[model samples]
Target: MSYENKILQMKKLLKKNNTQHVIEKEPILKPDVPNYAGIWQDAGLKMIENDFGVVFLLEKHYPLDYKHGAIYLRELYDAFGKWQQTQNAHPISLTDANNLIFYDTETTGLKGVGTHIFLNGLLEESEDGFTLKQYVLADPSNEVAFLFESKFWQGRKTIITYNGKSFDWPQLQTRWTLNKKDLPPLKEHDHLDLFHGSKRIWKNDIARMKLTQVEEEKLGFTRLDDVPGYLAPIIYLDAVKSGQPDALLKVLQHNEWDLLSLLTLYVQATNLLCEGIAEESATTYTNIGKWYADLREIDRSEELLQQVTNQYTREEAVNAYYHLGFQQKKQQNYIEARKSFQQALPYLQGRQQIIALIELAKIFEHRDKNYEFALEMTKQALKLVTESSLWTKESKTLRLADIQKRKNRLERKK
Candidate 1:
């Protein structure tokens, strides 16, 4: 069936199933009228028209006292500005508060041409604090109108969202293409996907990295009486079909909260990044140290890893010490690197222990020129592999053979 025909069929099914509970008991609005000013006004929303078509919008201003989590909204905005400056990639020009847009969308389903974006929520910093503007597609046919009317993609320098790069933005692009609408110049904006940053920082602490989980656990924001996003399509279909504003209101509320949470999460994550990992958990410090190391921030990485080694248990400190040793070795601090490697050996077990042994053996042989010590370390590693059940006999035999070669070479040097 044609896409338009499919949409018409879905609308028919929705209207046929609309009960009084789903539809408002008031007089029904005629479908022939393209304008929904009266209906939207009655529902506490404003209908606005652009060159594209008529779309419904609701704008709300939140005061400085509005608390998303532990931090007030104003404080969050300040932190976000600070965080943006610190980011090496996609450095945001936060000189104008209006340049940034925190965006989130509620869609009919995960993906594809059939799915439609029902709502788009955006939070921008205004002179009177923070302003949240939501564009609602009262009818699926108004999707283009809503997207065009919002103008979020045009003026913004930075667009922040949770998993939007993978899901939300792509879905919108697909819809725009299917509708043959001109794609907005979103390429001009720096898109920051909070999902990647959140996962990098909090994956060890929070197992499930969903936006809701991040809100509750990390930001300390709890949502109340909100509809799940998956059920949004059903509720939206019912509302559109029945011409009722109730379910759509709930969807708008949910979308608004999502945008607010995105702001909170972005602020929290950026604050954490800027403040350093001094107060975080041992594992967090170690993980963050590794992340910095990957980014080649050698001094900062060493400092954090050293904190883990100083305060955490041997088991907790093992990997940190290994990383610290590697960093030291890169800087040619052989003596300090040796101490770190030795500190790690006692806590390491299984494959890690074997790896540590090889590392120490290399350090002794190559750096210290201590052939006897290198041979001893290699012999010990071979003995452990022979006795332990960690490796299969064939694997152990191969390791033994490799170790034997190292031992023979070292002994000959001695």
Candidate 2:
């Protein structure tokens, strides 16, 4: 069926028989997404009626995240996969998908030096109006730990942050550690860091990889009047000192739009990724090779891999060759495996170097019975490894021991 039809079907399944559900459904048919304020109006009303606290709508003149550009869907999926084993919900059918926390913090200093955590602004939803909780540093010992230390972050598993992976995660980890508190095992949580992720995808056209640019260009998000982040410290300080909450409100709104922009980004990225791999000639050939290899369909894998051999990059060519080598090895085709490994050896370096070396060693030792050469390769592997790797030390130790035993047997025969 058509893509829109699939979306409609998924929407139908997810559509709840409630006012909020109907409201959410109405927007899907719109010609274009309404402005940021329009979204706040609808979501805010529901929040207010349910006694959710007032949604702080802050606007920032500068982009929230200046690093990282647009990200590809597949790249995001891979990153998310590293953190989470599975998604809570499928891409199109997002019903019952737990809400995400789109968070950003404006700190006293960017260097992360010293013990100066000046302010943390968080925009979250409640049954009442939407709430923007600003943790202020009234004194040197101001602890914003309670905001994150609570069970609020426990239930939900997905965290969508602009540059959380690099800046926010480390800072928060340090803060939690300082408090002698346990963080909520966020490594297992699906973290979508838009900064690096976006950079990977949109590094070509988007000159500035800032959140503000993506908001304006991609999501059509704009704020008429907003305070810049450079002035956030001043604004927040004044609001705290004189009991003037208006200046602080603008910062809150800036954070609030950040939260919404993150959501829109998720929606957009998911839509793009869910469209499946791009069908360009080169991309199609590479993906077909990937798909078949993943499924262990060696014949089909080899066919596609060969087709894409000269067309794609060296990395893709290496990957395809490795899989072909693996399939041939499994079939006891040692000569073919060696040929494939030779093709792949040019691309092997660093971590991949050790892996390819070990594989070649195994072929010599187990299949070819070239114990002397195998022992040399294993020694090379041992020399290259400095830390824990995908292959365990115990496994390497056993392999080395076995190779030693083989060498002894060969020596006895000699």
Candidate 3:
């Protein structure tokens, strides 16, 4: 018989074989199975409700619409912006064991507000790549491997996840909350979310940095004959209802690939930061400097900052100058740091102009004891703040407070 005829035969047998309580198998209609059809909803509802609550219905496939995918991409972009602002404070690197955990998840849907996650996969480095322990809910009752109640995660340190900050972590936490189950103490486990990391390093380089694309490009791994991601939940439900536990192989493979891809992405991102091209190297140094600063390793932070300053282009040079100045100021080396800020003064404008003026004020007020010069610098900063409509309320308030406080201090000195 033809493939379509065999599939029809299998469907007929499946329809009759699957009852409310018993899982029956019809004889194999063909040596090889047919491609997956749109019977996932039928399988899922039956498994979930223990009754055939829904029937199979196939809608026209619209794989390229991507309206929801676009939203996800934009969300990732905004997340990258946030990471860029703070990456210097918490840089994503493979070396920081006290600051990393590999996290992955298997979910029924994408929306966190209402979607459900059927499995939570947490991985750690093993001999080869990563040892994954997938916490799955096999039936409605039995804990697949007793994962949810396992004490293995009790005091573990960090969670390194892709988009976990926004999605996976929150989803898992919400699931635990709903179950009223004790969640392993996670607050202490600092998160290094890799989605932002990947975007930061690859946004301009790759057309799409989706996990599949990254796996193909970076790791040279590709899926062959794999089930589509959207169909995973359907397959899982089908396997459950029919007790054809073997049907879960595809979904299991998908989940495993997701877990491994997260690791591969992490490694690739770290490698890029460590060994990138010239301009990219400068960006990496700047980002690494910020991460060290966040970790309170001022020496490492200063060294990385110096790397950026040494090889920086005009734009990078300006940012490097500002950061080096701030780092020196933090270390109480006002004289040298003042020179760094002054170096950028020619190109610095707007907010940067305001910041430079404030630093100069600090030099005169505290170091030089030149209160008159300090007062002049503060006045210039205040003027700039007034001129800029984009100045934040907090910025205006802080500037006014600093200027007035200096004025009072100067009065006392005089």
lDDT of each: 0.77, 0.55, 0.60
Those runs of model 3 whose alpha carbons end farther than 4 Å from true positions after fitting are: 1-101, 110-115, 119-160, 165-257, 268-281, 365-376, 391-398, 401-414
- The digit string of per-residue lDDT tens for model 2 on 1-414 reads 999999998787666545355443222111222123243344331111111112222322223232223433223334344225433233222322345455677655555445345445554433322344544443233343333332344665556688888886667666656644323443345666877645543444467878888777665667658778678777755654564566666766676667666655765544433333343334344444555455565565566666656566766567667766777788889988877776887786666667676788778777787767666666666666644355578886775576456445545533
Candidate 2: worst-modelled 10 consecutive residues by lDDT: 45-54
The lDDT of model 2 is 0.55
Work out how many backbone clashes candidate 1 has: 0
Q: Which of 2 and 3 is ahead in lDDT?
A: 3
Write one digit per residue (lDDT tens) for candidate 1, span 128-232: 688999888868656667777767456636788889999988877777666543436434467888888778777577879988898888788888898988889
**Candidate 3's residue-wise lDDT over 162-251, tens digit each?**
778888777766665554432334344577787777765554455786777866755557877777878867766675577464556566
Candidate 1 clashing pairs, residues 3+ apart or interchain: none
TM-score on alpha carbons, each prediction? 0.80, 0.43, 0.54
The TM-score of predicted model 3 comes to 0.54
> Which candidate number maximizes lDDT?
1
For model 2 the TM-score comes to 0.43
Model 2 CA lDDT for position 242: 62
